[model samples]
Target: MAELYELSMLLGDLEEQLVTCMRCGMCQAVCPLYAETGRETDVARGKIVLLEHLSRELLKEPEAVKQRLENCLLCGSCAAACPSGVKVLDLFLKARAIINGYLGLPPAKKAVFRQIMTRPALFNRLISIASRFQGVFTRPAGEILGASCARFESALLQDRHFMPLARIPWHAKMPETDEPAGPDKTKVAFYPGCLVDKVFPDVAKSSFKALRHHGVKIYMPANQACCGIPALSSGDRKAFMQMVRCNLELFADKDFQYLLTPCATCTATIKEIWPMMGQYFPPEEQEKITALAAKTMDITQFIADKYVLQRKYDDSVDKGGVKVTYHDPCHLKKSLNVHVQPRTLIRVNPAYTFVEMDEADRCCGMGGSFGLQHYDLSKKVGNRKRQNIYQSGAEVVSTACPACMLQLIDLLSQSHAGIRVKHAVQIYAQGLG
Candidate 1:
């Protein structure tokens, strides 16, 4: 049984933050999962109430309470629209830490986060093996989408279709770089995150082209760890802390005006969530986090804001270009409020006609580790996004998150659809030369 005092102390910490929530229920309107299930428990307000109950000692099962809290997308919708200015994501993350402190993460995630992700070398090797053996387990599901499904039933591999790991993750191809700021301009560090470095190396390569085109010097580091969003969301703070420390150490000495990432999750996590959880760090480390958080920027924001995009398009130019639509990742849009710049980058690419997908800002159901904990629900949520993607009638789909890329590819492929996936930078970088 969880002690009253310990739970009480956690409740004490949550007290002020909880009071900010006025129960306005605005979160219900935009929540994708709540829209599908129509379950109050699925919405942010209901989850907040359940958490309040635990704080007051009314809710008994910490496990049950934890389960309800875990059901959320952490998309920041509630926080975004909130009038009373409640930090819902903050509360959820803290509550996760408290609950995990009491009950601990499950064995499998513990292994994955603590063992695999915390160690960069081992994680790379493990993914390398998984990439090699992928065909033995998965079969083609979407030709146009290039998605695949599990060959056999398994807990981890359900009916979801997904992009198989790249044959050579970007790390193996281009381990690292340290180029000086061009004679004309500024320097920036780039953290591609795991998915981009591995599955979506094209995204990284394309981003490099775009950044360099802007005359932004690149400082790509080697032996980088996962951003730890997957681990932290699963309530594994130890692993998450390890990842932050690892990245902090690698980039600490480098003198750069900005640190950037193509992945929305990494941008959001490092900029927002990292400092939110900085209470656990030492005084000096906490300062380092503050500096890092202040400096990190999404690639689109960096490009659109730092430099003027070069455009040489006429209505008739590249009329035969690929048709593409964009999806706004929850982290990129709701978390960091970076909705338009990516699309602007799309607009800059005259080679591809930028088509607007239905509900372009909707979540694609790849909520970090939320998919792992709830695959069926994740796919169901992703289903709406797939319809929106198809309904747009575009031949290609683009998004900023590699996690979303995997999810979209899976859903698009599952329907046996033919939709190519591209990063916004990939589209824009092509027009540079």
Candidate 2:
């Protein structure tokens, strides 16, 4: 077991950063978890106070503090809304790392993060095999939503409607590629995050279509590792850093003008969190992170900014455009300030009508593994998003993040809302005719 003194050393680095919090209660208005629980301890302000106390030895139970820290959705809502510009997510993440270091990770999470997640090839192979048998345990819950629930009685999957893994994952489809720049003379290294690679390969295919349509060259290396967000968010810094180094080793020497992904979480992780967490690394690794972060872009942002400029926005709604509503993924909109570009892609398609849902920017509550840890709370947050979607009265709903897409599909499927969920890239790619 790790010692408190060790945790203090780790958390000492966060004290100066934590002192910047003003406790103005602005975070309360935006924090999804706080809104649901109505507990001060659930919000950033409360967490900051607790961190301050723990750091000074005022709080005896580091376990209690650890629980509070893990309760967060990490959706960047409070951080986005903070008036004093508090690095709330950064602080919480570092603090979680401190607490988790001392307290240790749960056995299950330790196995997943350390054994399965860090080993990319083994992880993919296992998931590929597991994907074949998942259908045996789960029966279709919603055809339109593409979701499944446990076939029989089971405590683990009680009533969850989840998107099964793709029968053929993205990597299996296009194992590797190194296409030179097309007429546009632009090359990109594509990073399909885990969810997109194993669960939503269509998004990857769509991204490839959009890229090829615009004459962007592709450098998609096979057996790409996880984005390290899962390990980082789980407070497994060792695993997180290992995964990061794995990716850097793969992508560092690649010649590409941009690193792109359809997954909003992947985009935000690479763009914002990578640079933010690079401080503890060596100078060379830090420089590599900075360079990579500079070139990373969400696929939608890349398309709207670079490709759409060359062509006119299609205004051909006369073709009886499909009524589609957009869900602003918290990672894309709040973390990276990428709000308009996704909608712009929908509008440019001319095959879809972009409808704005109520509280479109609110979190879908699929904080990667958060949903698995606290299903009831996750469902409560997700239900709010479902209500907003149903109220929008759109036939189809789209979001940029695969995780958000998973949550929406689950919520809508369980509610029997009969709405189709899709990634924004899939919608745009289908319209690329």
Candidate 3:
């Protein structure tokens, strides 16, 4: 009872944003989870109502409210579709921190987020060791996608086709560099978010290849921290801030025109979420964060905006090339409005014919930890995306986010779809050859 009072008090801080939701039901039209379950509690308006009730002490079941909140994908669909222009994602994230502050996090999450993730070196070492022994417990599930499944039935693995960690992480291959820009070239810092570093090192390689092809200088720093979205979404503000501070320190002195990342999620987190959550930091720290966020750009966005010539080409021009479709990650499309840049990158590649997939901007259902906690719901949402990809009749599917690549690969591979998955940068880089 006392804890509930304290939680409500904490939630009181968001009362202004909470009341912004007019319950217009605009969120329903775009919510992927609500579309699957048709449950009121799964939608933004429903969740907002619950938070309001909890804040007012009109609700008694904190556990039930917490469960309903955790069931969300945090894909920003509701916030994007809101006619009221409510800051739905910001309100929900802050409410989550308030609720979890009173309820407390699970032991496992505490150890992982606070202990392992906050320390980049330890986290990298652990993932490296796990990569070496992963072959023992997992077997190849999809040949073309390079996905794996558990050798024996396991609760965690559970017949899911997942991309395995790279044998050698990207940083190990190119630990750090301070390459100078060529004549009339721009210098940019490269950030390979956790997934890109550990699971899809090729994306990092392709990003480098593409940047070099354009005569852009590179300045990759050592010991880059996780973007902290995982920790923040899990309601661990402490861990999230730790990561932000670590990254701020690393890039504080580096001289670069822009900060670029191959991962859409990382780009959004740095450019949007970092500034949104910067209120917790000191004034000087907030200024640094704001500056960094301003300079952060998605790799595809950087290439398309600065280099690619925007001109419409007839589909017949590239008819002989492999047909490729783009999937707009929720973070890239909804949060950052980056839907067009990645497509531009794909369209510029003469070796690939770009096809428009139905609902290309829809969420691929990998909401960071959301998929891990709600695999059944996640798969239900992802199956829809897979169906759209199949209908496109494309030989390859490309996206800007590595996490989306993970989800798309799983969905397409599990259904035995022959379509290959590649990052837009990868497709663009291949064309440079």
Write one digit per residue (lDDT tens) for candidate 2, span 58-130.
Answer: 3478777777888989998998989899998888888878877867899988999899889999999999999
Residue-level error in angstroms, candidate 2, position 314: 12
| Position 114, candidate 2: lDDT | 90
lDDT of 3 by residue, 115-159 (tens): 999999999999999999999999999799999999998877787
- Runs of candidate 1 exceeding 4 Å displacement: 1-10, 55-59, 309-320
Q: Worst 10-residue stretch by lDDT in candidate 1? A: 309-318
Instruction: Give the top-scoring candidate (TM-score).
Output: 3
Ranking, lDDT, top scorer first: 3, 2, 1
Candidate 1 lDDT by residue in tens digits, 1-433 = 5444555566677776887777889988988789878999878789877777764433367777777888888878777878887888888887887788677678987998888899998999999999999999998775675667889997888787777788888888886899877786599999999989888888888898898777778888888998888888877878999999999998977889899999999999999999998877899999999999999999988887667554543433446678788999888998888977887787776678877888888888878778877888888888889898888888989888888888888777767677888777787788788
Per-model TM-score on C-alpha atoms: 0.93, 0.95, 0.96
Give the candidate order by descending TM-score. 3, 2, 1
**Global fold similarity of model 3 (TM-score):** 0.96
lDDT for position 413 in model 3: 86
Clashing pairs in 2: none
lDDT of each: 0.83, 0.87, 0.89
